[model samples]
Target: MGKYEQLAKDIIKNVGGKENVLSLTHCVTRLRFQLKDEGKANTDVLKNMDGVVTVMQTAGQYQVVIGNHVPDVFKDVCEVAGISGGEGSGEKVKRKFSEAALDIISGIFMPSIGILCASGILKGVNIILDMAGLIPAASGLGQILAGAADAMFWFFPIILGFNAFKKLGGNPYLGMTLGAALCYPALQGVNLNVLGFNVNATYTSTMLPILVMSFIAVPMEKWLNKVVPDVVKTFVVPAVVLFVCVPVGFCLIGPAANEVGAIINNVIQGAYGFSPIVAGILLGFLWQLLVMVGCHVLVVLPMMMGLMAGEPQPLMAVVAFPSFVQTGAVFAIWLKSKNKKLKTIALPAWISGIFGVTEPAIYGVTLPNGKQFILTCVGAGVIGGLSVLLGVSQFTMGGMGVFALPAMIDPANGSGSIISAVIVAVAAIVIGFIIAFVTYKDKKEAVIENKEEKLVKGREVICSPLNGNVLPLSEAKDDAFAQGLLGNGVAIDPADGKVVSPVDGTVMTLFPTKHAIGLVSDNGAEILIHLGMDTVKLDGKYFEAHVKQGDKVKKGDVLVTCDVEAIKAEGYSMITPVIVTNTADYLDVVEMASGTVKAGDDIISCLN
Candidate 1:
């Protein structure tokens, strides 16, 4: 069995089983599921499951956050659930128009994003090497590399056709055949008189025409399948699809789609040309927000159409710095935070953001803090507007972050644009860092406690595990704890780092990180003590365990010791939560301590 087989099975079971799934797709860190009925999924169980990060329902996609290794889990899920081609055997549930459009766009493009970005990077590098005079454009090595870099874009119609047809539930090879015919060399600039109608258009590097052709071909192929004999159906359907699609595409779709693309490009360029700075500021400020909601791809489609039609994209250039802006904010957090766990997440997120992947930085650090995310957007807007004022624009699609700078180098315009790009990126990072560092504040919880009550008979008394001020679990920064999703509990702003046993019990689980421990009391009470919020990311740093899993322990026995000052210095909150994981197993769990607590003082009473 695969490593994620069991996890995949569990996910399938909780997500209303395989029968409820309409389709499944994935991007980077999430498994996007389109379900027949969203209400049937067990969201809470999936959230608390091991190996899962979180779950989200947005844009008509039930998203399962599975971290970076989501692809592996997605594969295992498909295998275990008998899901072929990521589509389930059921009629798709009707979705809102906007949601359906977003799903269709994502399905068509997401599968190709990685290769597209890699190709863009290669093209950018080739341009740099040629400009440097190290590899002249006419040199054999340069020509070979140029071909490799340009092939994907030059033949993009065929690629788009294959993906589009597959997404629409049609045969992909037929789509490819139609796309190939459109790009045939003899057809370029050819004027054909078919019933006194002139059909002349160049289809190389085009997008919209093939997309239209694929949509038309699916229904045509379906109609042919019904009339054709079974023995010759395969060959006849494909033959008919190609013959009909190619001419219709060239005669009608190609010319019309080209004009439509031109109109859209002209409008965008006109608006951008009217006030470059305002356009820049607006795009930069809203780009990340659009990305958060998965609507950014809709914006990219028109820009891509324009780029392929030989138009400059100043708007994309302006919005390019948002990732770097996020990087800057994460850097500030890394420098300012004393929490080892947060610092650990921040550093890597910052690094990935620099490489043009900001999901880690956005979801992991900035968005969670709220203020820092806004500061980064403000920084991006300022830099984006400045970039326009300084005359920066992109001539071609390129890789993100630092790798995108090469696209700013307009061979006809000298080095001015590239210089502007560098200035904007550096300024964004510096400004974002300064703004976030000065304005960002760590979360602080107010301490409040109920009046003390004496433990009564037929109840179990659990003592305080650490010296601390009392805090209600409802006020915890973590949603799973604050909402009581993990079970009823109260939190503590620890005055000391020592974690002692609260009852005579056996250690049920000791987390490898040493940041949490679980015990089963002799009186049938289950207790879980978590040392800090997100402290698991610390990976055992500054934590020492005195007892291992399955060890027998009595009340007041020291179970673990943490470096209080060191953890605080690292910027981690030492607000610990002692939860009764099996809260339903008892009558009620009540708080017994008020205001402050010392180890060995009764802090909770589990009523029988």
Candidate 2:
């Protein structure tokens, strides 16, 4: 089986099984699901599952945040669930108009975002190379690179039509045919007169025309499917769909949508033309907020439209500074925070933000601490205003963060715009770092016990939770555990089915599946005992918990019991990992036991 196959199966089972899913789609870091009944999902269970970051419900999407590897998980979910093209039949839930619109936009745009970013980066790189005199604009290599960069935008209508039609529950190939007709070379710059009405428009590289066509085609295809006979309906429906949609798109939808797009572009240009700095400040301050709520797509669609029209996009340029700003805030948190757990989250989040992906920074670090997030926004606004004042504008859509600098280099203006971009980026980081470092304060934990009076002093021992042969965590099957992403630990190949408390502490987290338990020792070592690899998929069938969350237990007290033979019969390995989840808080977590052990024996030592 594939690496994520079990994870995918577990996810599908917890989300009310495959029967409850209406559709499944994904973005860079999330699996977006449209469920037939949201109430049926075991949300808490999924949240506690390994490999999952968090769960969110917004804009009618049940979002499973899965980090950067979401695409792989998404694929496995589709395959394991037998989902074809993300389409499933179920009763529709009543939703607000705004919610419905947001859902549709996310469904249509998110699937293609990766390729769009890649193409934009390629275009930006080509421009940078040309400006450096490494390649002339008219050279064969430059021309080839330009074609590769421009292909996605030039054929955007086809891509949009395919996704939009599928999202609307219509035949996608018919949508593609309509988009092709709109983009046909011979039809460009054409004027057609029908019944004394003149239809004149250019449709290549446009979005609205195909979107409108997809909307109209859904109902049209539905009606045709009902009236036409079954055997011939296969060929007939498509033929009729293309025949009607192509003409209506060219004569009516194409001209009207193009006009609307032009009006939107002109209005945005007029607003920026009035006061660029004000526009920049507003976008910079509010952009991350919009992303947090999943509403950024509304702004992105228009910006993409403007870019395809060969217009300079200052709005996108202004918004790009927030990633660096978020990074700066994370750096401050990493440098100043005493909480080891928060520091671990901050460091990776800071690295991700540099690459222009700020979700980790926003969700993992800054937003949880309100002051840093606000400071980051304030820094972004200040830098954004400065960027516009310095005349920084993007001539093409590009990758995020520092990578976006190349797109700001306007060949006609030499390197002046790119220089301004660099200045804005550096200023954003500096301002964000200073503001957050100066203003941010870690919340003081309420002291429950006097540290000096504790028996353990600056050291603690973790007793064996299971009677088993000890194994280094490096030899474990899962990379997350083996590599210590979940924290440093040692694994045990269990010889018994029972789990005992290794320390005197309260239960910190107890998974609904009974396959994992988290404990916080009185001496402050946070430990996690995961029952087995991929055992969460058993859904509590072969496991039982002796204690609930928040229960206090002494060392050697029974915490959980497992049906070892039954779990193994079902193909799950019974190797449990006893991890110090907050390993960074201590100087070292030294494995003390080697070959075999009894439940009450000391297995590891935590030194402070």
Candidate 3:
């Protein structure tokens, strides 16, 4: 009942009052949900909701992109909705076969990636030290540090088991027990007989073994839960499960998983061996496009890890630097835009993209602008292919380009991988920058406001745009206007049909019919002054435009003059809705005065 309680409740209500939510989990920046009905979500309201960056339905999961503080929000969301805040994984979501496969891989492996990345980074640090002769690999200190760094992968099944169990809604320790059984130290030794079966294969640091083990073990755990009595469940579940699952796991599951692993390893190795350049080009170019079409950034996770059983990973190398391409595109828009809204989204998104967060850039900037996104993709593809040609490859999982530099460094040899990565990143950034900067012509376009740009801070006092009797937006006959979808502000029954500027700023848009004018204030709020319901039908018959698009105007300056009597005689609604098109940017929009006033009378309070 604190900071995020209300927000959580609002989110739940809008997501179909918790009934529609089949499962819930969260990643670093997203609230990933498996919903019973995707259609039930009030996506518009959630997207407009404060604290939410955007709403996305991707890879068969509904993702609410909430940067940084998702964990806290996710906890509140679970508590408020009375659903398991399970690590957003393992639900049987409805999706295409490929997407379903990717979803399962991501959902199961995602929660444990933090451990993998941490271990990888630690190992990378040791690599730097060990290679530089700062620490001898055989020394006691080196051994301890190496153990600390390598533990995650050395006994990966255990870590994966814990996360996968939580994801599958089973007792996590049991999953750990199963993992330990697969990677049991004794099993790694020469021929070991377990339960009259000769166990030969060792399952260490491989993906398929633990997955196959769980494919059998998790379901077994679920079956056990149903049949086992409550009184004996405590001792019986583990006692019987470990007894049966362990030996069967060693004899059956482990061997099958190894075979699958070998097949996948061969396939990936063969592909890279065939052509790294082509693979890199395809991955780099399509990665952002995939993201645009609802593929999560981690969609290539399985491919990267699966390939890691043997081959050097080109997936990460090709994909990492391309983010700079998106950053570059947004930066271009920021530099070129005259409209405050586009500039605002672009500037922040561009800054965030440099540090390896591209959602802001993709969702906020490029994706909306067709040409700009295409240019960014072109730059990324060229740079990405060039990176592979320069021998840029990732040795371990890490963040985007600069952040992934350490991971890119070869652990076995002090190779110039990081050097190559740096060059690739720089090239990508430069290429993307040039492409986006030159390709995007802002001459006439810069003046147009980004339709999706929300209102800015300030502009709290909105003076009446016309001499009119103020009314709520509900007075409008049109559903979109009355529902405040266009924005929040009061409708007015005009005393005089002269529409004046509500805020001192540039007129960003003037509709051809002269029925509406969009303005950007000095402070940044976007105001849309719609003359009246269906006024466009009059086709300038009863309306006279006083300002052209892109004209800078002050408050009280006449925007358009209309004849109320003439419009009424023509059958158009006389109620003019003076709406702030980006009202979602503000905390509240209050009607300050309902009855009467002259133009420039502050009638609405746009609270922040």
- The TM-score values for the models, in the order shown, are 0.75, 0.82, 0.72
Taking the candidates one at a time, how many backbone clashes does each contain? 6, 0, 1
- Write candidate 3's Cα lDDT for 1-608 as tens digits: 45678669778877877777766766657888777678888785576544677788877778888766678898899889876665432335466887666556656776776667677677777788888899987889999999997777778888888767776677889889888878878778468776677768877776667777776777877888889999888878888878987777778877887777677667776887798788778777787877655464454655555634645676666778878888777777788776444565577678878877787777666765667777787788887789889987778766553566777887656578877888888888878778877777642211223463333344367788888788877677764466444556788899888889988899987766788778888877777777877666566788889999889999999999888998898888888887776665665565667788789987766766
Q: Which is the winner by TM-score between candidate 1 and candidate 2?
A: 2
lDDT of 1 at 13: 84
Cα-lDDT of candidate 3: 0.74
Report the number of the highest-TM-score candidate: 2
Best by lDDT: 2
Estimate every model's Cα lDDT from 0 to 1: 0.80, 0.82, 0.74
The lDDT-based order of candidates, best leading, equals: 2, 1, 3
User: Which stretches of model 2 miss by more than 4 angstroms?
Assistant: 336-340, 440-497, 500-514, 517-529, 532-557, 562-608
**Model 1, 590: alpha-carbon shift in Å?**
20
Ten contiguous residues with the weakest lDDT in model 3: 443-452
TM-score of 1: 0.75
